[model samples]
Target: MKALSHLNKYLLKYKWYLIWGTTFTVISNLFGIIPAQLVRYSLDLVKETLDIYFLYNGSRLQSNLYDVFAFSILFYGLLILAMALLKGFFLFLVRQTLIVMSRHIEYDLKNEIYLHYQTLPLSFFRQHNTGDLMARISEDVSKVRMYVGPSIMYGLNLITLFVLVISYMVSINARLSLYVLLPLPVLSVAIYVVNTIIIKRSEEIQRSLSRLSTFVQEAFSGIRVLKAFVREENSATNFTVESDVYKQKSLQLTRVDSLFFPLIMLLVGFSNVLVVYVGGQEILTGRLTPGNIMEFILYVNMLTWPVMALGWTTSQTQRAAASQQRINEFLAVKTDLVSEKSLEREIAGEVEFRNVRFVYPDSGIVALKNFNLNVKAGETVAILGTTGSGKSSLANLLTRMYDPTDGVILIDGIPLKEYSLTSIRRQMGYVPQEVFLFSETISNNVKFGMPEMPQEKVEQAVKDADLYQNIIEFPEKFDTRIGERGVTLSGGQKQRLSIARAIARDPKILILDDCLSAVDTNTENIILNNLHRIMENRTSVVISHRVSSAKLADKILVLDEGEVVEHGTHEELLAANGVYRELYEKQLQAEEV
Candidate 1:
């Protein structure tokens, strides 16, 4: 019960539906019980009225009795038909209200989880896998829905039937009712024992499924790498191992269900045998009529379903509880980053980091130590560094992808914490080292950052990124669909597309973290030349390994091992005979070759 506490609020949202659904289920069960009584009465009528019709033909008693018998059968048949029709109608309403509500809850829950995913910091994604998250959103939510829909309604139906049937049986003959109900306590104990195992196994099954989903997602995402390395057979063997584990867990759950459900049926069968044996003697001694015994048997037969339902409801409830626990665990995660205040004034792109230090959460190794720099409006500052020198870390802090472990970062002299994340980030355009593009049209991908931009502005951004001519070469031009991660486009084209997307926003600050690395040096020069005019009034941060690219910046800062080694214009750094000079000379020699 504690496992399902998280779903209470969502269930309350549809309380009216729940009320009506319960009403419909109760009515349906009540109607379903009526046919058994009608069967008993119709049989008794035949026994009482048969002799009169044959012995006294055309007499008043005969005529009246015959008419009564005929009418009873007709009424009995009509009642059965009417009950069936009414039960079907109400059952439809039960499904509409309850089953549909479950689907609605599923929709709400999935959306909530998706929104939570968006709000989580990068560290959370680092800790969780894409496939596991996908499984929770899809499969786990579906399992919870089973409890919300069928388990709830069916459990209610079973209760209604038990109350109505048991009360009627007790009224007919309390002795027989007591004898027939003897096995139920035993069945209850069995259900409890089996359901405990079911719950544990269900949790294991869900976890195994999550692992399987994660494996498939990873395998497909890295399919190219695997094929290039000729690891197809190895991947298959790994997949088979995971698949077998899921199968074994599933089979274990099925085995438990197999044992428990049949045990319930056997208990029901035993109760029927008891009623027949005890009531047969009562009929012989004239204490109970044949019709009375038959009615009791009919009532017990109706009780069988509730008995069977007891086992099913228990199993499904346990499974749902397990799934709910997993979902709640995920939803309970608190993000490390949040906005404490919102700045109403727009950012001017005067970025400064004062005595900043950053250490990754997972590694606990400092990526940047005592990092300090300031870029005024209308200036371009290029960050040049070796791998792991925290070039990208600076861009991350500026965009609020991460916060420094110590000290402050400010945009226009205001602390980053004072501004809302979106407010500060909205002013900045950042292109990461690795670019990702959705499966969408060329134009759609370009306008992803600014969907409502004028066509002329979009075209200008494409031209400025130097990707316009290549896009025009496609048969449908901007309308052409790029495959997943822009697999349909060349490496250089993908990077250019990312640049165009960033430029489409016309942000006050632009940070390109090795975005144009895939393009040729000539294309890189062309793109940088185009950005020169655009960077004239806005601050720009370029993180690059190439000295040729950084040479265009107003100031070039060289970083080594997470600390700044030198800072100056390209010519001044060259004359200083430092790290920048060493990199420039090597690059110049490489290009000359």
Candidate 2:
């Protein structure tokens, strides 16, 4: 119940819908109960007229009274039909207002969750799986909608009908009404007990559902791997286990849910029996008539559906509460990447790391320690390092994907945090070790960073990356659609496409993080020759292990175990006979062989 309180704002937002729906519900119930009274009047009129007919049997007056009696019964029947039609119309209005409001709220809620997801840090994503996140937005939201829409509408209907029907019953015969309602207290106790059990079971069922969704999502996403490894049977067995767990949990809930209507009907049945037995005693004492008994029966029948609906409404509300609790947990998480300043400024690409140290939050691995570097604007610096030497960490910090734990990073003499994230990212083009491209046309992927880029610039970027020939060979050229994550392209082609995307942005600062590892030496040389011209005025940081890639840089750095072991120009580093020289000599021998 407390978790459901989060929706109070949405309720207030659509208060007019709720107000009108409530009005309609009340009117519908009012019209509904009137038919029972009409039944009572028709029954009493028939009883009285029959008695009069008996008294005037075979007399001249009997025939005249017969027509009047027929007309009276026909009039009451018409009134009952009108009441039913009016009740139905109001019910339609109730669904239009309330149900439509729920849909509007659902739209707003999903958008809010998705927008919040975009703001969360990468570490948050690392901690959660894709399937669970998707379940929260899709499945959990649907359950909450049930609470806001059908559960609320039916719950209100139940209360309204009960009030009208019970009040009328008491007014006619208090003693008989008391006996008929005696079983209701027992029904109340049953509802309370069942509601408690349902909430617990509902939570279990939701958790099982999430696990099942995750299993199916992972299985499909890795189907290629599974087939390559010949693990189809094993995967199917695992799926069966997850499915069985979900099935058992659902059945448990259904078993409990199945008790609801029967218990309600049983209590209702007792109420009906009490109405008949007690009403008969009242008639024997001349305090009640046959019309009263018949009307009481009609009223009890009128209350039956609402009472039966109570179980369903309660179950849905409990499920909704469980789902809302899950949603609230994520909504309450605060991202640590808040910007202290949001001013947009032009980045001159003079990047500096002053005593920077960082540790990966999830793995607790120290990726950088006392790392310091300064690159002047319009300079090219190549960082050479072996695996696990913290080469990629610099790129992550420069992009502000993760902040350093210890020191400050500055761009153009301004602290990195001083500029807005959007401004900083917009001016910098980064090609990471792991390249990702959308399942879109070649031109669209190239122009992703700048959607409005011209076709000439797109061609130039493709040429600069040395991928122009391959793209032109395709039937659609730049318009060719690459499959998911560029799966249709070869590894080198994918890496080159990523480079073309970065180049298309025309960024002031360009960082290529080992993007040429897959291309042949000839292709790499061509790209480097083109980059020599592109890097003339722009700040560029080329991170790689190959000595050939660093030969053109103004300065070269050799990193060992998260620390800089050597730094100098290529000629100076070769003359120094240190780690950089050793790496160069080894790579040169391998190329010669």
Candidate 3:
């Protein structure tokens, strides 16, 4: 029961269901005791009437012995039938109430975990793998439900039946009741020892399973890489290693679970032997009758099922405890990011960064240092940088994906932290260097940011991205299903689709971070031409390595090694003879070649 303390709140919330379910289970077991009692009474009646051919009724009316016997059998048969029906009805209620409550709790628990996942900072996700999270919510959740539902119901049933049957056995013969009770203490100790091992082993099995799931998920995600490298054999070997680890852990858990039932059976066998040995002597010594012996045997037999169930229930309870501990670890993690601001207003798209500095957690390298930028409303600022020059870090800060370690970022003259996260994020449309699309229809992907966006707006967005001609070529047009991560679409098409999705939201600020790198130069020019009209009076920040992409910007800032190196208009940067000029000359040489 201590193992179930983690679920106490849920249990208390559904306390009424537990109460009613247990009440019905107790009632069902009470009715279950009747058949054994009736069998004993019938045998005693037979013994008493063996010498009489006819019996005298209370009114001195002689009745045939056959009729008397028939009447008694018929009366007890109906009693047993009625009790059986009642037991079945109550048992059904027990399952319906408690099991359904467990399902409801499972749903609520999963939703809470998912909500917590959403609240956690980006760094938390960077630390946890997708497959491990999936395993916690899926497999571990089901395991907890087993403890909440069937294990609980069966446990209640065993307790109720054990009490009633043991009481009846004691009343029939106190000495024999003592014999039956002898094995129970040893059985309890065995359960305690075996279940301790079960808890540890179940945890190991769950962790191993999570590793295997992660391996499979990663392998499938990188199947193309494996195929391109012709490394299927290596991947198979790695998978076998992980699979073997999981198998070994599962076998260890099974070995622990396998010990409980046999110990219970041995104890039960010893109890039966005691019952026969003790009861036969009592009957022969004229202290007990044959009918009394039968009654004690029946009661002992009734105890057997519950004793077996005790083992099973104990096993399930330990497994569920192991799962509960795992889930609790996730729930106990406090979210690093907290939203305290209540401001929710339309953004005017004026952006500024003042002496902003940032370093990623556990990394000594700085991503951004003393970065300063101020873009007035309706200005288009382009950022030029090489790999690892903090281009994406700026976009991440603007979107509030990560907060600056030092200095302030302001939106519309207000501190970024003063605004609600949702309001700030909703006002910005970002297209990252690595584009991701859901496995959905093209129209759905386009409307992903704003699901209720009008169809006409979706069409206009696609047209603006210069993707209309390519999209209409598909057999299903806007309704075409792009498979996982939009794999069926070319890299350029995926980038364009990502742009359309952002534009469809009609955000106040548009941040494009190297989104056009996948498109050809000719296509990039066409898209830029369309963007000129879209960028009018819209605060936009474009990050790219291409000089051609920055030519139309109101300002261009060059970054080298996480610090701003130079800043000017495109023409001015070209004449500055700095990092920007060097990069421009190299691109020109490569293109000319």
lDDT of 2 by residue, 1-593 (tens): 89999999999999999999999999999999898888888888988899999999999899999999999999999999999999999999999999999999899889989999988877888888888899999999999999999998999999988898889999999999999889888888888898899999888888888888888888887777999999999999998999998899889889989998999888888888998999999999999998899999988888888888888998899999999999999999878776788869887789899999999898899988899999999999999999999999999899988889999999999989888998889999999898899989999999996889999999999999999999999999999999887888999999999999997898999999999999988899999999999998899999998989996799988998899999999999999999999999999999888
Q: For candidate 3, lDDT tens digit of each residue in 316-337?
A: 8888888888888888888645
Give the distance in Å from residue 40's predicted Cα in candidate 3 to where it truly belongs.
Answer: 1.1
Model 1 sits at a Cα RMSD from the real structure of 1.7
Using all chains and alpha carbons, the TM-scores for the candidates as numbered come to: 0.97, 0.95, 0.95
Could you arrange the candidates by lDDT from highest to lowest? Answer: 2, 1, 3
Q: Which ranges of candidate 1 are over 4 A from the true structure?
A: 51-64, 284-287
Each prediction's total of clashing residue pairs, residues at least 3 apart in sequence or on different chains, is 0, 0, 0
RMSD of each: 1.7, 1.9, 2.4
C-alpha local distance difference test of each model: 0.88, 0.91, 0.87
Worst 10 residues of 3 by lDDT: 53-62
Q: Which is better, 1 or 3, measured by TM-score? A: 1
TM-score for candidate 3: 0.95
Candidate order, TM-score descending: 1, 3, 2
- Clashing residue pairs in candidate 1 are none
Clashing pairs in 3: none
